[model samples]
Target chain A: MHLLAIDWIFLLEKLILIVIIISISLGVAMYSTWWERKVAAWIQDRIGPNRAGPLGLLQPLADGLKLFMKEEIFPASSNKILFLLGPCLAMLTAMMTSAVVPWASHLHIAGRDVPLQIADVNIGILYVFGVVSMGVYGVMIGGWASNNKFSLMAAVRGASQIISYELAMGLALIALVLHTGSLSLGVIVEQQAHQGYWNIVLQPLGFLIFFVCALAECNRTPFDLSEAESELNFGYHQEYSSMKLGFYLFAEYVNMFISSVIMATLYFGGYHIPFIHIADPNFAALAGFIFLFAKTAAFITVFMWIRWTVPRFRYDQLMNLGWKGLIPLALINLLITAVVILLHTQH
Target chain B: MNVTQILFWLLSALTVFSALVVITRKNPVYSVLWLIITFISISGHYILLNAQFLAVVNVIVYAGAIMVLFLFVIMLMNLNADAEPQKNKWLQFAGVIAGGCLALVIIAALKNVDAKARIAETGSDIGLIENLGKVLFTQYVLPFEISSVLFLSAMVGAVVIGKKN
Candidate 1:
């Protein structure tokens, strides 16, 4: 008699999980800025952001408010719609990537077993790459809409860099996909948890190439040629102000967080620490979330450390590393992996 | 109609709308962006048919990489609505004739396609990667490898030409 039979409970569960994950991602990205400053301060022998709150914990909140309160400027010569579209697109793509990532094992709550993920789609890896590639529009449209030459230059650089690294990144990911034989992130993580060793043990070179590509992808230091202050003058977001600029900056951190989570999922055994077994399923799920969180935190710290430690790469060097170095290295690793898999199967 | 039908109609409208915008836009950057939207909506249609692999690959390759290069070239040229070159009347007439001929050909080609005769394929797994991969590697491996060789040669040609220039 009903028009449509619906699983309302399932719908409600997903809604709650969505809210929680979004909050966690935003919260983590906010704190990551604090952590980055603290790391930078530590490196330079200075105490950072003690005045904002305890350990400058509220600095991000302060920053957010300042951004919100700031005046918004639409350039007289700029395309108004695209200028606004840029930041929103960036933020949207950043948030969309979390949809395919399996955050943890199944959770037993409200008398129903709920997965701690949004959508564990079959083409999860491709979905991530597609959404990430879409992220270039944020920079491209934003910079172009600024009607500034430097902004245009930055956008062009960013678009090219992202396009190049995505090649190497896809090549690197192919080796892992070949090893796992599944594009689903959930399935890959489950395989790693059940297997004795993580994929990193089998594919270290793939991990390295993937890591470098990730740095380039996120526009992080050393690979951040598009945002080179000396040459491009703050790069793509140069004309963006108010909350729009904040969104661009926030999207970058979210991207970094997501990439680290992806690396952990693909290489590190995600939530599974080998030989440490927990009998209770619910507790195991909770522990898995914690483990995944800890790994991402470690990765974020490493990202920050690299940002402070390494000097930015020259444009040509960056291109050379991606094209000549990582691409060839990834190709070799892929070949080796194929041979190994083939040999093992013959036995 | 149900949700699937509703989604089909919605995506069809979106695809047509975006495609029209792509052609009509004065600014090439905006045109490219609209074309990207058109491709995305087409990908949505692929997903509606449960062709997950094709849907994602379309987005990753066509909408992501190819469209970005188009956008890059257009943006670097600093072209705008005001800068768009005017076309000649006879050239425009010839262009219209060509496009109309293409539309006619496509329509004639698809006129024999009768979908209603076949059973509605609900929950078909043929579009899934596992099935696609098996069929492709086993039955269509020769063509697949040949296309890849074609792509490799194209890549080499591009690199060689760029180096020489």
Candidate 2:
């Protein structure tokens, strides 16, 4: 009976950690808008959104409020329930991916150890894949419920594109999984931190394939074929107005932010301080959090930079690149990794 | 009730409810969405059984990939309530008879099992990736490879059928 008792302290710690993590994700996603605009402006030789606050820091807030204040236009022909469920689903799935991600090293406080992550589920990476795959429903439902042809077309494109890229992404990850021999993100990060050799050294080719597939998954340029403005007109979220549209947009930024964290955590050594060791556990954990944040920020900057740098891929080109280019490359990388690991183990 | 028992009951109700909704929904898209919900609740059941790998992969494969493709086809078909073909009352009666027979078979099949067998209560490492992978690769290797080959053949058959001269 005593063994059946619940750990209230564990639940409380996880609850607090979840709240803190989601807020940080939201804040980062908000500022990611500002950062994207700044990057886009920089590339185009223009000052971007300097009006809202200093360095346009408060622009995301103003933009969010503006979206909130705008009229919500629900189409007469739309399926009301599914239409509303669409954006909510998008936001929910986007936030759900963060549950397994280890944000930093374990913190020691008041003679108790606290981990930054919410749920370090056993099948961490697979759980992320499951949630990420479910993201397509938001686009699909939003488009289908709108009862608009353009929206339907965009949704079909978005759905297929995600499905295609996920294969390459999964294949790319198989190599890393084989190398690490574990699926837990915390364990993976801990290994990288202690070993001082990031998975990137052995997984550069896989990382490149992963990076391209990630771009496709995020629906950023040059893989932004689903929302091609020249043809699909406002894309899957076309008929959405006000905060509904805002949810769709915010979900994209949230996804981008989360993917940045995932890439940093996977390829780079997440939260690992390069060439430095701190004695105090609490201070080290704090430093690790900042380090992971900086790496994630770097990845986010690269995402935005590429978005502005490359033109959108043609629909056929996007499919070809996903199915033809990246998948085979990832497969070859997997084989090479397998052989290397085999030889190393035999020695 | 224990946490495991409570969660098991909740998930079972959700699965049954959503599965019923899936069959009852007039709109094809709604039916597909409800089916996804059914699959997800089943995945929850897997989680409750401490089959973490099975649970997430169920979500990834069934609810995520297969259901998306199902929804995609239904969406593209532009099906409506008006488009649904009317079923004869006798056909419905026949379906009920068929379903009852299936249920009878299942119940009779399970009658020999221990009724008090613990499922969700025990946190078993048998479902963990390491153990599952080891067993699957060794003892069940033949079946695993055969299923993979079957999938490959099916895929190849699809491509061949889909190709135009």
Candidate 3:
């Protein structure tokens, strides 16, 4: 009964924080689409999308408006309900991971200290993994509901690809968990921040495995066989149009943004501003938030850069890399970590 | 009612409703989706018991991975209502009778239990990852290792079955 006591201020704070985080995620996702195009253009030696506003800043807005205005199409053969459920689920799973991510250390407001995260759940990393796994259903159901052969095929490929990469991703995470000895993202980040040495320095191989898995998990290029335009003819979202299609596309960008944030938080000393020390608590919180955003932005840029630079892998090659290459490598890394910890403890 | 009691009743109701839907759905795909809802409601019950690790793992393993595989197989087989053959009337009658008898037997077996004495306070931290990990590695280490070996054998069996002729 004591645990069930309701605190109105705490509830209100969480509600407001949730709203802010959701809006921030949506805003970052919107800009990521613009940034992706800009990066692609720059890499190819072309000025990209400079028409909507200064340096094509308003292009995502234009794209959003166009998608909203487009005709909504539901094929005659398609399952009406599940087709709609697809993008909604996609958007949901994309946003859900943000709940556990510690955006900054802590902000003191009105004589009260507030944690910047929505929920510091005990099993934060597992929650993220669960939500990410659920993300496959959105693509799977949407493609199947379309009632098209190619769409179904694409859905199957997407589901299998996600499952395959997830094993390696979990293995990579286990290695890091062994080093940190915690499942809570906040605890992991705080440990790194206190020590001033990120997990990346100690777990370089684990980070590389994790980075590859993140690319596959987000369905970025070199791993985006599900939506290969040349082969599958627009793939899973082919039958979707208007806002439905926009949601699926938007969800992809949001997933990218979240994964980039996850990468920064898990390995790159999240919100840990290095080489500069601040004594003031309030100032440190703001600086930490900015530093985390900068790291996430850098990761997002790398995601886009690789998307443009690397060619799409053949399906077999993708499977081989995930199952044979990354999984075994991650296992070896975990074994090495365990042995090192054992030796150090004995000494 | 207390918050915990209210949440327990709500989640139980959802689980029952979804389980009913799972059994009654005409489409296998819809049935799978309803089963996922059932799993999610059960996970909510686990969370209510403060087993956060089990709650998340239940969703990841059952609703996420297993259900996705079920959906993939259903799609691959193109299983539709039209493809399902109707059972004979006598067989259907026997199924209902058998199910009712099983339910009666279970109820009879549990009728003697003291339910009120078994009720305990919730929000225990024993279900947290750290506590559970310690218990599993220290006290249940042999069983854990045995289960992993079982999984390895199952995997090898699957590979053998899946090999091309």
Best by lDDT: 3
| DockQ scores for all predicted structures | 0.73, 0.76, 0.77
Task: Indicate the worst ten consecutive residues by lDDT in candidate 2 chain A.
Answer: A1-10
lDDT of 2 by residue, A166-237 (tens): 999999999999988888999899889888899999899999999998888888888877688899998999
- Using alpha carbons, what is the TM-score of model 3? 0.98
Q: Per-residue alpha-carbon lDDT of model 1 for A1-347, expressed as tens digits?
A: 23545567777778998999999999999999999999999999999988888888899999999999999999898889999999999999998899988998888876778898899999999999999999999999998999999999998999899999999999999999999999999999999988888999999999999999999999999888888999999999999899999999999999999999999999998877678888877999999999999999999999999999999999999999999999999999999999999999999
Candidate 1 CAPRI classification by DockQ: medium
Candidate 3: segments with Cα more than 4 A from true spot: A1-4
Model 3: fraction of the reference interface contacts it also forms:
0.87
User: lDDT score, residue A253, model 1?
Assistant: 98
* Per-residue lDDT over A1-347 for candidate 3, one digit per residue giving the tens place of the 0 to 100 score: 13467677888899999999999999999999999999999999999999998888999999999999999999999999999999999999999999999998888788989999999997999999999999999999999999999999898998999999999999999989988888899999999988889999999999999999999999899899999989999989989999999999999999999999999999999988878888877888999999999999999999999999999999999999998899999999999999999898898
Candidate 3 lDDT tens digits, B1-165? 777789999999999999999998889999999999999999999899889999999999999999999999998998998899988999999999999999999999999999999865475788888999999999999999999999999999998998868
DockQ, 0 to 1 scale, candidate 3: 0.77
Per-residue error for B73 in candidate 1, Å, reads: 1.1
Identify the superior model by lDDT, candidate 1 or candidate 2.
1
Kindly report which residue pairs in candidate 1 clash with one another. Answer: none
**What TM-score against the true chain A does chain A of each candidate get?**
0.98, 0.98, 0.98
